[model samples]
Target: MTKLQSGMSRRYFLQVTGSGLVTATALGGSALQARAEPYDTFTWISPRGTLEVLDDYPYWSALKMGYFGDLKTEMQPGPSDGTATVKFVDVGQADMGFPSPGVFSFAIENGMNLKSVFHMGARDTFSIAFRKGEGTRDLKQLEGKTILLGSAAWQSIVDPMLAAQGVDITKVNYVEAGWPTWATALAAGQGDAALSWEGLRAEWIANGLEFEYWLGVQHSTLPANTFVVRSADLEDPDRKAFLEKYLRGWAMGLEFGYLNPRAAVEAVYEQFPTFASNTGPELGTTSILQQINVFRGDMENREGWGWHDMSSWQAFFDQIHAIGQITKPVKAEDVCTNELIAAANDFDHEKVKADAEAYQLSEEFAAIDVENIQAHMFDNAV
Candidate 1:
């Protein structure tokens, strides 16, 4: 066996990247701290290279709404290698990460020792996009057709989603057409379909790259992306307390958005001005609502936000295993836990709703006919 050379940790690499945005103050405690002192900063690394997307509105909403309180936070855009989110969290480069269940499974199978504490995307967000009126409605028709992807690492995400629909994933061709341009590649008639998702459906339309989509929320029953962290870190009381506070911020943020979505969009716009100028108020708000619909699934029947259904996750793992994506029998409990759900949701709902409704909106954002937007939200849903 060959021994690997020792290198700098992912944390050090993140510091050197000069891309981290420090947004808050420290709650005090390092990953290895033995005492009860509060940690300085809690860094969250995104799976993608940019945080300007609408997919993470809850975090930004929390930031703008002062939900995180005194807990200092940093948001880092991890490399687009796909596995870097969980890998960074596992190596202590970041305190938390947002990763799909498929990526989380891969980490568990490879002994990464991470746990998904927050089930953010309660429903499937993955979708297959096709050129308008130029593609078949049937997923089985996708067999043997070329599918464009932003990265080869996304194959792990695409394979299970395709297999769930009775498509022969082995026969489906995936081409890495590069990020922020794969849909352009598809529009250029280079592929039959491209991997797309919910929030992106609206953002793409805003960018004028419209496409018809077979949305996973309407098609599949699998669990979507979730917030994960190193399993070993949870054993520390101080760290766990910090986590509870951090997640509470997200829960409150979700509640805020669910109450008044336009405010959430405004929060994202306030956080990233450039992103606002590009997507604009109409589609940007639409994108925020699109993701919220995925994040809030049957709230009347569920316990609360970030709650995980063990059976659904088990079924997901079973399906991926049947598709040969996972080599071993991986149990749901081994990779995720609902332990933090209650603490994360320990907040006043009515108060959050009050805050959301009272939030002042810009004339442009307030002018959006939200009822009309919701009515047409599913126009391209297959």
Candidate 2:
């Protein structure tokens, strides 16, 4: 679950007016094809910074596993913004891109020829965290309290989530503060709660901090980031071949990562050597793993990998439409196709599960320890 900022048309709210915002096919088609051949190359763009975060893990892991076969991945670095990703695919500069599903709907309504091919992760990483033992039992309890956000940009996201819960947003005070200093502000009692990531949940629990929290996804069964491509790519000169192979590799990497988290980090570091960081290697590993953990909050309960329920998508888009975020009609069937995912789900799930369960880290990766970065990660666990 990560924030995907699709370039929504900016509307000035001068207190006088308002504004608005906004899979998978695989999946496993290699079955009947004779010695499959993957497509030539796929130019893909990521929603976040280039190959640096956990959100890009499966793609990196796939590269590590050589699942791509003949298909070469040409990565175009994103501006680290979701809207940019939507733009990349819209203009055909890239064949595929990743962006938050919430913002993605706007792209479709605005007449972008994109369709989400797979449920990268159906839930967002966003959560509201406040001081533990603050007597806040549920999210609705913050009726008249303050919720802190990094910027006014958060309103499009947090407001819908709040309104969905039936908590009158006007009744609750919203404080704008710099994310760098939001933690201090929260500690100083300047805000009752702050928006955060699910990765912080485990850290707070491990440290015995009773930070009361509610995940936006838990309250709103919304779609998060997705693996998307142009509708033309699905039809003429169809790219489903590449899509299916790409997903298999992706799914494989994810299973391997689960079995060997440290190795997964090392794979990305090794494959994307350009991603040098001032942060230590261990911190990078921990951060990537934590972000990977975000998916499990909802994935573990799903029927299979990359499963996207129509009802969930409807609930989210319905809410968005109800809130006047989108007025143009965009049918889900036109934008998403499950044929590929159904094919992928048909893969040997039982075997994949067993392999992952029995997986052991290589010597190089086994040396990593969570404690190495725990001290630095407690407050900001990406």
Best by TM-score: 1
User: Over 4 Å off in model 2, which ranges?
Assistant: 1-40, 131-137, 141-154, 170-193, 199-212, 217-220, 271-303, 328-331, 345-382
| TM-score list, all predictions | 0.90, 0.69
Q: Positional deviation of 301 in candidate 1, in angstroms?
A: 2.2
Q: Per-residue lDDT for 194-275 in model 2, tens only?
A: 8665544443343344466666544555666677876656664336666777777677667666665666666767665655
Total clashes in model 2, counting residue pairs 3 or more apart in sequence or in different chains = 19
What residue runs in model 1 are displaced by over 4 Å at the alpha carbon? 1-38
Please report how far candidate 2 places residue 283 from its true position, in Å: 6.1
For model 1, state the Cα shift of residue 325 in Å: 1.0
Q: After superposition, how far is residue 379 of candidate 1 from its true place, in Å?
A: 0.7
lDDT scores of the candidates, listed in order: 0.81, 0.59
Candidate 1 residue lDDT tens string, 136-199: 5589999879999988778888888888888898899989998878989999999999998889
